[model samples]
Target: MKWPILQAFPSFSPRYLRPFLRLCAQQSALIIGKKLHALILTTGLSATQTSFLLNTLLHFYASCGDILSAQKLFVEIPHSCKDIADWTALMSSFSRQNRPHDALRLFAQMLENSIQIDDVPMVCLFSVCAWLRDVGVGSQGHGCVVKMGFEGKVKVSNAMMDMYGKCGMVREMRRVFDEMKEKNVVSWTVVLDGVLKWEGVRSGRLLFDEMPERNEVAWTIMVVGCVGSGFSKDGFLLLSEMVFHWGFKLNHITLCSLLSACAQSGDVVMGRWVHVYGLKLMGTEMDIMVGTATLDMYAKCGRVDTAVKVFECMPRRNVVSWNAMLSGLAMHGRGRVALDMFPRMIEEVKPDDLTFIAVLSACSHSGLIDQGSYYFDNLESLYGITPKIDHYACMVDLLGRAGRLEDAQTLINQMPIPPNEVVLGSLLGSCNSHGKLQLAERVLQKLTEMNPLNTEYHILLSNMYALAGKRQKANSLRKVLTTKGIRKVPGMSSIHVDGHVHQFSAGDKSHPRTQEIYLMLDDMVRRLRSAGYIPNPASQVFSGSDGIEDDAMDLEEKEQALFSHSEKLAVCFGLLSTKPGTPLYIFKNLRICQDCHAALKIVSKIYYREIVVRDRNRFHCFKQGSCSCCDFW
Candidate 1:
């Protein structure tokens, strides 16, 4: 398709070239742009005309993601003709390309050339600073903002706050917020977000209450932040206020954020409500973001069948959408189904890094070693994705879980990049599972060398010792930990009931209905015993069990420790509170113990109730005396 101007190139006016160049840049018509550049050179335009056109030409290349061309053209532009826009455009291109160091270098050159800084360039500089997380450079930019009298600009001020917040300079961010003479919704929201990151949900809520105006973004931030930090009740209340009280319409991002929060908190009631609301708001057509988020919420909340329905109904799908479905299946221990979906995914949208991570994890969870090995071996050759640490971690986990400890170790040693905590941790977990005490010790030594202050690794090894009947070694380790003032992080579990989340620790008595909870637990134990539920001896020695002493324990004491584990307490409370046949959703901060897992299997059958537990690793759905994982997990 030839443009009319190209047919009559000789008669083309310089003014005509400006709009054509502008259009080419707008649409990123690179070939058309190259022809126009040739025409400009051949037409022999005057110096001033060419100079003006050069700025637009430079921007065209930048807009098309041709950083090299943009840089070359920037160099070609005469110093006298170059302005702040040209400098800013090139710097922005570098920033967009994730070359923040290059952007900083250009900024320095612009400063050397005596180019005046404006709000736009300063904002770009702050973004680069944020990406670099360089507070020294960011502080210098703040000084420049003050020096240049651009401090009053809202966008500039917001960028500064964002940079500071991302760099963990929360106090500086707050100071900037306090000193601002004028504040808008974004201003309040930025400060609120920073406060949430540094000071936790309670402080964020306090700041949110004080805001003069609340928009959807501010509400979303507060809601997601609260739910993410284990404050589900407050998060739900905030959502209610945002909708019913303020009558604010929820956008897809807001809906997605809320759904993700619901997933994190395992609040199925809220998740279902959000799904229905999204359906109504967006009509029958489900876009990718909302659909994927809704699917993830269901999957995380232990409803993979519903997630599959949502996945099938989505009007559009991307790699992320496919990954969500695959991950959902993986979470439910449906590895073959997840693998089957992978072929179908690549038939439509191309798979990415996260997609492989989900697939490999599925294989690992289901003990599909052959399939996992094939995919991992061909990741680079077949998919053009160089295996990252996460991929290696998944492979390690796969081999380790299958009792191929030597093979897993060999793979880790052969990895190009060093194994991260997750990779080594996977191997450590596998070693413990297989009772390879010597191998577990070696892995623990490597883990401790990598992160000496990581208490979880120490506790894992201690639990192994206790389980192996080496009580002296376990007691010594516990004493050393206590002497060093490093207390083990207690396990916590929460269940959503009647729109309120009830949190419990082992032996927790904090609930108002504590007496009833204990009585219900006593009944559960009796019923479980009648149903032939014996506490796992391994579960008894888990190091973080609350109220358990470091001293050697008798068999009766060990069994006592097992009964009061956090998930059991939460389950007992759920049973006591909810009606008969009501499904219970439990979210735990740690993995479900062996005793809880076995007991919950019996509890589901005896009580005629379905129990879904989402622990740190994956989802477990118990029904009719069987678990969704089929005892693999």
Candidate 2:
């Protein structure tokens, strides 16, 4: 690839200088390009071959990210000598720098100056419009393309399809695709993405099958789209097809997307399988992205210990990797371990805003008040990171959890920024836990002012009232919410069995194995009662008519209601479906109630099986009548 030396060739020949300039641009060798430019000018080649060299110079400056230099060179070119390629180079430089507005402005200037438009510049302009998601500008570009008779060109037509698709004009995008006399993989892929975004996974899958040929990108898009649409199982099937049927090597992106799907669906079994398959594909050469995704997947699936192993196995770690690991630890209630990792992390890479969030949350969850306070105090001075709202919320949570209600309130009042609902909600949660009825009322008032329609705050306050034996007040709150038609989110629990996720709600009988599940539930209840298990009546949030306390219901009936809880049903179904020694992994949409949490500990010991429940707050690993949280959560 070596070029002839300057003295070794005819300096006046554009042929020799053109290739040399191209080489410099490709290598991003600014000094070499400038020297070559000087050689061209000194030899008076610029006077005769000005137009040819100017376009190359513009491209060189554009490639090197010197947009200013390129602009200057572009402006100095004589108006008659200026061509569409020069404009494209300048427009493309701005586009590459994410300056779509500037690129559009150049296009407007080209129109005003009466410059003849060509397909190349038109394609660049359409791409700029797509990046901006500006449907108005894209439509105008489309008209110009048609006027210039460039719509017949395949690349220009593909750009048009991409522009309309990105702008959310799906019908227009499809029309362009349908009318195209020629179509390539890019054409099919662009329209497929639009269908996935505007339509759902089913329609996207339909169009995907219609494609004459598929590439890695198309497969990856379907996988990611399926994951986002809550069809992770289908995404896995697509991956299997791509691998087993097509024999395509799984790229890092596809692997990461599959891992993300597993995490979202809480499918740890499939996550482990994907991890092993990724190892086979990449072997020991797995990059930071895939490794980080694996760590996050294990962490999110309630396997923090295995996530730690993945983190340790990574050949290289970045700030993102550290943050993912720390968040996982924080999420699983391993605050002490997360804190220990922070010092080591800072020695290699500086902590960012997200890092502090993870560290502070770890302290809050672990009730390390002293450590949390020290970190909060030194956030600005030592770490040069200011305490954001999330940090304030965590500090408030830590203080409240430690029974410092007055101090938590004082800190909230002293916050430089107004406290958000999350901060107020944390304080309210702690208040409920500590039975600070008066403080909880004040926090609830502020929360109501922030978001009146938020039924969660109301429910928390009502539950607090019920726990305090203020049955009348609790009923009143429930009646008001019912009148307004503001119902709280229903509790849901899901368990992944045999690669399919089964979800259950309170009193749900939608599953095909309902009869078997109920029989197992009956057996579990009899065993539990014999083991001296008594339902905590105070945790019965939905036991009565319209969520009112069922004062007339006897103890046995209340116990029946408790057993019908979503988590209980999921647990019973797991017990019936899984092997005796198998561990049950249950994911819940809300916090585990006091009754369920207590009952699960006994169930773990009596059944002689480990049960890992990932509730809204944290992981609860119940084993032998003990929970990993030590009953703190």
Candidate 3:
């Protein structure tokens, strides 16, 4: 009664083998894959089975990035036998490999082959169209989906939304979203994120508010939207509301968004709090994104040491992590360290434009002119990255800072694209620094012609004229400004005192503590005089009539005006209010005036205190009768 040998052979189903082979492919278990292939052949099912088994095998190979194997297996399948799943899988594989053109070609071939299009193919095609920004291809995919009656499929609808959004066609995305009768959390997220990415944060917030149901993704999208639109404070506010008010748990994405917000806002305290809480929630196994955001937060908040610590502790580091550390070093004036990290980054993870920019900026800050030039040249020679306007501007700044004005101008002249305001402005700034009046005049002419509305260019040009004793030209420029009703931007200073920011401007006496501030300033001046500080009468501009006598009077009036300059008054206020040893930190809207600079050096030595002033250009750390800039700025 024993069964025949043919009957004893176990009847196998491809479905049971399909998932197993997929797992093997995903894990890159080549040995296992060969073993399974051999098993399929020995089982005598390879030839007898439908194309389903062969297509599954082909998909497995494609998913594993074995494109050659996939192509060979695809060839083995009869041309007339290609199905929708086979075509979709191959196209998706190509898309994943960043061969979008190949993917599109395959899609076109599938359509020509008259394969029955399905939801999967529609999603894949839509994604390819989006990546290529082919509005026409996207429309064709949409038409196919409509013909197939798959418009309601969530996956297909989401792909269409993404396509429209990326093409800057928010209206089309909205139409697709409106037609979807049943939207899951992912559906809403897709539409909301698309709107946010395309239209901006305000529109994203509007969509967020309109949503009836909210999820972690919804909140995260809104937080990112705010961050993208430069509303970091608003993003942080939204994050706080989500956690404390809404009782939502924070995820890695949420932490990244919140940390990014803190970085942009320079809110160190809030950033630290978020970092601590994130660690408590996610533990020490932080993802690269969260860790990078944390590093960026510390760096931007003037805690570069903290940023370095976070970076060093990261279990895994990507290009962004390296860039963050490099930027932190640059920001802290540790340009050598930044430069040191550059080669290491190149060896490890190839430098990008941003990385080079960071390195160039560090070189500019630390005056590493040779290294800066080498990197600048190498950006094109080695990396094949033609310098953009920003790169050129950085180089101009580097050479200009090093007193290579003519070389800087030559670089500008050689720029492939016409120099924009930033490039020319940088050159003009260098000219002003080096007292190259003629060169500055030429640069200013080009700048004013291109940017008539730019007030800073006019101010700088006038200052240059005044510095060179071109009194009539300066006077004429002033008259022009007056006629145009364009007032000089008032100099403003901010001092952090008693956990609040106190703002002051030139001739500002509106503060409630104005009388106390002035009295303190007067006393400080006496002390400064006793410490051998002498007033410089030449640090002023004449603003009266055209005659020599009136000009002399105007010069005297200008010197008196310097005494009331915002930075001087802010420093005096700090001296009066703060403890004698505490370092004073002041932020200024403009470069520190010459008189204020001289006065701060005397004030620092007289009071035996350190003063750190951040002006429009760079940090000036004054201590012991000298500034960090060495009076070069």
Candidate 4:
């Protein structure tokens, strides 16, 4: 293994040194590998005519992550010494680095040259295609593999499944899997993961049950599918089955999946339960990933203080861990806390795109205009995190929410890329909030062109017209919606109690306890009215604004509209079911309306309950007539 000994055998042929270089390539130590490379070069043991030594050298560098050196040698390789494996090695390096564009281009070059490619390179290409989620290239690769008869190969077939699966093409991936004559655990797992992505967890569970033999990965996929598909309770059930019944060791992946489900559903009880399980599984030695997930779940479930404790106590912190805390704070509207964590995070780990996005979102949700401006302005220069559409969207939302309508529009105009629907929608929402009819109309026109079928813009514009007292325009808009058969998707709110989630839409009365829920609602409204609370009429105007004639409604009708909103129904149900002083957590599909927020504040005081509402934008913790976000949202 010593390079000094390689020179002692000065008469050794390149063939004799090939195995050692191959061994070096497999082991992958930069310093140890560089030593071997120096030995080959110094001894002139690497022949210019023979490609075996060059291929091994290239593989050594590429696999060792010295990709630049591999690329240099790859480009300079003599025509006679070049081989398909050489290109594949480079492609794999790029693929591992998530640089699929470079890998795909190199693969195209191989096809153009008509090089004699086999399954190894084809498999690598498909793997990159899967990561890139490029359906076109994946189809081409699939065809090529079939023509070359590599489709029969398990590795190649599995790669196709993975590529299609990640692309959300569940049927294609399943087809590839079903046709494969020989299958491995990875083959089943890849297809199952793909199904989970496109299909729901129920579908993924069916697949999991159908598997002839389930491995750890199969179990992990089902757990992930359940949590990712909004069935956190199901995910926990799967995790328990995997560990207790199947005798599979509880791992970080399983724990993380459960935590993710708890975060998504805002089930603090389940989140804490998962936290306890993670501690039991890992003991005092907590992994960074599991710790991060636990912290994220607590923060998202309205326990920011607990998340902070976890962040401080984590044995090791990474970019991902820091991003989780920052994003969680952003979700809870703790923008100042998130910003304060940034400098400390900088000293520990370099911020990436996700980091900046979290920071920008925190600023946007918390009205940190100056802080948001600094981060959005200097993100690229300071952190080298290039701003994508989401980043730009956050910046626009920040500016728009701050009443800088013209500045938000200017930022949209100045975007290096065209503004997406989210950016345009943010500007439009600002217009709706500030009653800027002219800007709202301009933004609406662009939005309608971008997504002609979506009725949200139409509804928003109709609201704008009604708010501006343009009754004729509002009526014309409603007529257009009726003519086009466009109906707005109704907003919904959900609350989890004991293990089941109860969901309600606007004016909902479908719950089995609907009678009792409304009765409780009457009591709550009476109590709130007695406490000097009044139903906001503005809340009435937007209540049935989807083509409804709000101008025709009387004051009493408006009050009924406020009382019938989905969140109000869910809260009333909570009051009916839960104990006094118990916190009520409600999650809304859309932004919590000003009226609902105002009502919840008084309800919190009247009921002597802490009410937590997580809407589309951020968390609002209502306690004793005040909110955590302070009405900023």
**TM-score top scorer:** 1
Pairs that collide in candidate 4 are: none
lDDT of 3 by residue, 1-633 (tens): 332432423555676777778888789776667666666767667564746678878878888877777878888888766677778878898988889999889888887877777799788888888888888889888888888899879999998988888787888888999999988777778888888887888878887888888998789888767755546567768878988999999878778877886665445545787899877876778888999999998876556678989988888888888988886676556788888777777777877788877888888878889999998998888998878888999899899988999899889889999999988998888887788888888888898899777667766767668768887887687667668886666778877565345778876799889998888777876787787766654454421111111244555465556666788788888988898898787767677777678889888887888887766665677888887666654
Cα lDDT tens digits for candidate 4, 145-258:
888889789988988888898888888888888788999889989988888878777778888898989988788778767765557677768777887898987578877876
Q: What count of clashes does model 4 give?
A: 0
Q: Number of clashing pairs, model 2?
A: 0
lDDT of 3 at 214: 91
TM-score of each: 0.90, 0.77, 0.63, 0.88
lDDT of 4: 0.83
- What TM-score should be assigned to candidate 4? 0.88
Q: Candidate 2 on 107-172: residue-level lDDT in tens?
A: 899889888888988889889989999989899989998888988899999899999988999999
Question: lDDT winner among the candidates?
Answer: 1
Q: Kindly list the per-residue Cα lDDT of model 1 for residues 1-633, writing each as its tens digit.
A: 545657744557567787888889899899989988987887677777787788889999998879999989999998877899999999999999999999999999989988878999999999999989998999999999999999899999999999999899999999998889988999899889888978999899899999999888999999888877777777878889889999988888889888988887777777898899999988778768999999999999888999999999998899899999999999889999999888889999999999999999999889899999999999999999999999999999999999999999999999999998999999998987888888888888898889877777778888889888897887787777788887777889988777777899987778899999889988999999998987776667764544366466777777777888899999999998899998888988888887788999999999999999988898889999999888776
The predicted structure with the larger TM-score, 1 or 3, is 1
Model 4: how far is 405 from its true place, Å?
Answer: 2.0
RMSD values for the candidates in order, in angstroms, are: 3.2, 5.7, 8.5, 3.5
Positional deviation of residue 267's Cα in model 2 after best superposition, in angstroms: 2.3
Each model's lDDT? 0.88, 0.85, 0.77, 0.83
